[model samples]
Target: MVMFAIIPYLALSAALDPLAPIIAGQLHMSAQTMSLGSGLGNAAYALGTVLAVQLGLHLPQRRMLLAYAALLVVGSVLTAVAQNAAMFIAGHTVQGLATSMLLIAAVPPLAIGYPRERLHTTVMIMNMGIFGAVALGPFIGGLQADADAWRPLFWIVTAVAVLALLLVVLTFEDAPPANPDAPRDLPAIALAAAGSLAAFLGASELTSHSFLDVEVIAPLLGGLALIAGLIVYQYRAAQPLLMVREMLTSAIPVAGVVTALFAAAASVSATALTASVLSETYGPVRVGLLFLPELGGAVIAAGVFGLVIARRSLHYLPLVGMILLAAGILVFRLGMPDSQPLALLGSALTGLALGATVAPALFVAGFSLPSASLPRVFAVVELLRAVAAFMIAPIFAHFAATVTGDLNEGTNIALWIGLGLALAGAALGVTIYALSGARPQTPDLDTFLAGQRPAWYSPPLLSRLRRSHDLDDLDVALPVPESVD
Candidate 1:
């Protein structure tokens, strides 16, 4: 069931990424138009987190999963039969939205409901579900691109969606909502969707129009402003939709969110840029072959995560992952467009970094909160992650294509930006570890959830910052620990 629910997103992404050019040519669309479709689809995926959470609060879990699966089938069919760019975008958007909704609705129960001894298995499942699928994307995309057709891939996805729907029906089990009477946060959903749409639309326009053009500037700025408002509103609402206050108050959770966002943005953008440059130069099959090492890297990282997940060293995992991610970006910045071996090495390293960091950070966030809050935490984190990671790809693609007259030079420039984001993310992870006073040794889940302040937490630098911002007031009491077994 889990495999069926999650693999479709990976299949679609992998198929679309390498085949973007083919799809564009077949539909008589520009690369920018294709990017717009991809960007909007991803944005819908990100924003759908809110909808998933809302529905989870009010709807029966199994029924919602089934509904989401049905929507996935419809979306995949629409994409398969799409005759124009608009139809394609609409279909892809629905696929993206439905996939995320299913993810948020289904995954948390597995994470929280399972026994503590089984957590390693849960983490492995997450790594495979997210990164494993991503690792396979290029291979699948390359094969289809080599075949010069996309409808077959879409048809396969339609079948997968159907399988997922059937799995939901066969495995049906009734589960009550976490809070059946929780009021819906309509404003949060509206802002999230609108902000994501506008931002992605603006970024997509950058392909055909200059960054200064109103089409690019207005939506970009307006969307950012709306998102800012959503944050403030979430912070103040007594029953916030996304638990913004809880995230902000905790050092570990803040770091996890930042790591997820920045790492995703950097890695996804780099992949898009490199794939674009390489596919044009060497063809899609060869380019896809180049990225096969990522699967190995993701597998190795997942193994490492399984080993350290229950130990205190888990705190340091994200930091190490971020460092690796930065190194990967550097590899691309230094050797892209001219060095295939270096690019392959970079791909493997980035894949390892992703497998190492994002999921571990998610685990950190989940453990930081009580079990009851797990769904909300996952929803909020995934929302921000989608916005940061997926939204940036099209913008990076636009820049790589047009930042300069030379495509290689343009890609190089974008790689530099990605490198900066990677380094920044690494530094943020370090800050989080330092601020939280997480030890190199692994602490028990209870110690972590207690929000223990580090010895250095009261040092002059932090004390002054805490005083200035009155951060102490935001501290939340740890819930009574629940027995894991």
Candidate 2:
């Protein structure tokens, strides 16, 4: 159910790259409209993370999960049978919102509900379901495009959504609200929704307008400012909706967040940008075929995640993933779209990088906090991850198109930046670990599941600078939020 519900939408997100033109032509829509619709969809996805957390705090768990799935089905149907732009955009936006909501509502339980022995399986499923689908999307899109048909793929996604909904019903179990007493935090919700929507909206405008144009820059900067304001507010609020302060103040969680964000931002060159360049030379089918190796890489990473999930080595997974990601970027730079071997190798490595980095970083963050706070912790990390990953693509795309007046030259230049992001992320995470004197220690999943303590020790920021001999005064742990004051 988790895999089915999640894969269709995420796959569709990437699949849209090739399907967009066919969609635009059939719907009698302009390029800008398609861009606008996609922008809104991305916004829903990014904002829905925070919204899911909020709902979890106050709603019936399983009941809401079912609702989210049903909503997803409706959205999928709308897109599948759409006759106009409004229907398609509305459905796409809902699919985005419902997918994230389903993710937050469904995944944490799978992570913490089972025994330690079973968590390895959960990690593998989650990694494959979330990231693997993304890895497979281009091939699926290319097939549909080569067929010169988009409805078939959309129908398939709708069918998957329906299956997911049925799975929800068969597996239903009643559960109470997580914490009814938690603050409403309407302000946080407003800020998150507005910031994500405006930011993506502005970025999407780049398809039709220059970066400096008011349509692109005004809302872009404003949305970013609002997101900054949201973080400050959440960090300072007496009873916040999310665990902003705790994650930011702890060395492990902070490192995890940095690793996740940077890996996501850097991996774009191997996927969307390269696909764009390839599309100019090869037809959709061939382009998708060349990138088919990405799915294999993702599968390997997923298997590796299952093996290391219970071990202390999980902490280093993202670092290794960063190294792989950098190698992949370097390969792409060797001559993406032109060098078939490098493109194949680069796609494989990038698939590995993405699957390895984000999932492990998320778990590392979860392990740094108590198990009960996993949803909130995931919400925060994912929100930032979505922003860094989704928003950076368009900006990079624009840069690649205009910088050298040569598409290939400009794309190679962008690959250089992606390489920097990967390295910088690795360096920052390593630096934080060093500064905090944090070691890669084994996590006690049993203790974490009991909500008794975090799986592993996460020292406060700058612990190396402040600790005494053997850290006598630092014995006490900072309190994590469970309910509103």
Q: List model 2 lDDT by residue over 1-485, tens digit each.
A: 88888888899988999999999999989999999999898899989999999998899999999999999999999999999999999999999999999889988888999888899988997897778789888999999999989999999999999999999999999999999888888999999999999999999999988999999999999999898899999999999888999999999999999999999899987678988998898989888887888888888999999999989899989999999999999988886657888889999999899889999999999999999999999899889988998898899999999998988889988989999999999999999999999899999988998889999999997688677634655454545559968
What is residue 473's positional error in candidate 2, in angstroms?
Answer: 18
Q: How many residue-pair clashes does candidate 1 contain?
A: 5
Which candidate number maximizes TM-score? 2
The number of clashing residue pairs in each candidate reads 5, 0
Candidate 1 has its poorest 10 consecutive residues by lDDT at: 453-462
Candidate 2 stretches with Cα past 4 Å from truth are 466-485
Query: How well is each residue in 264-298 modelled by candidate 1, as lDDT tens digits?
Result: 88886557788777776787778888888888888
Candidate 1 lDDT: 0.79
Local accuracy by lDDT, each model: 0.79, 0.91
The C-alpha stretches of model 1 lying farther than 4 A from their native spots are 28-32, 436-485
